[model samples]
Target: MSKERAQRRAEREREAAVLAAAKAAEAERHERREARRRAVASRLPKKRRGPSGVLADRRRTQTRLLVLAFLVLNVLVWLASGDWAVRILALVLTALVGPLVHILMTKN
Candidate 1:
């Protein structure tokens, strides 16, 4: 019958419209996710040290500064503190454990 064919055509049109809307929504969501990823990536700090050589250089520079600051602080402490026990303790610690703890404690 003509009415039956019309009903089937209408049903197919509705299904096609639903499928098209779903596809459009999925594409929009994908685009939104990509834009968000780009936004987050833009906020990150740029890595300056590419390859192994630059990284080694950075480590060496930091280590050298740490050692220099430690030595300077130790000399100042040795000159300032008058208590014999404290001075003796400093000397003993310097001889036994080296400058790392002394440097860390000097901040407090």
Candidate 2:
């Protein structure tokens, strides 16, 4: 009975040692990764945009999404109508939109 108890205790100790070693290795790896990330980040310049700049970026993104939706809808319209006029209109609008958005974004 005593021998069995000693064997069980030794087994538990071995498992505990293995778990501790794994944990230490994981921590070391995490630390190394964090150090590398910090080093890389330090090498890059930070881009700090003000409130209006942020708002403009947001607006630009919204405009792009809107323009994309418009183009898609117009394409569908052209496809459905199977008309040359519809295709030409869609093409003209799509061509003008990006520059128009850029102009509008830049002016404000």
Q: Among these predicted structures, which one has the highest lDDT?
A: 2
Model 2, span 43-102: residue lDDT tens = 999989745887778877877886777778787978788788888887787678867866
Q: Model 2, 92: alpha-carbon shift in Å?
A: 23
lDDT tens digits, residue span 8-87, model 1: 99999999999999999999999999999999999998768744687667665665876676577667777898777787
- Report the lDDT of model 1 for residue 76: 72
Clashing pairs in 1: none
Residue 53 lDDT in model 1? 85
Report the C-alpha displacement of residue 13, candidate 2, in angstroms.
0.6
Q: Candidate 2: how many backbone clashes?
A: 0
Lowest lDDT 10-residue stretch of candidate 2 = 99-108
Clash pairs of candidate 2?
none
TM-score of 2: 0.49
List residue ranges in candidate 2 displaced over 4 A.
52-108
The residue ranges of model 1 lying beyond 4 angstroms of the native Cα positions read: 47-49, 52-108
Top TM-score: which candidate number? 2
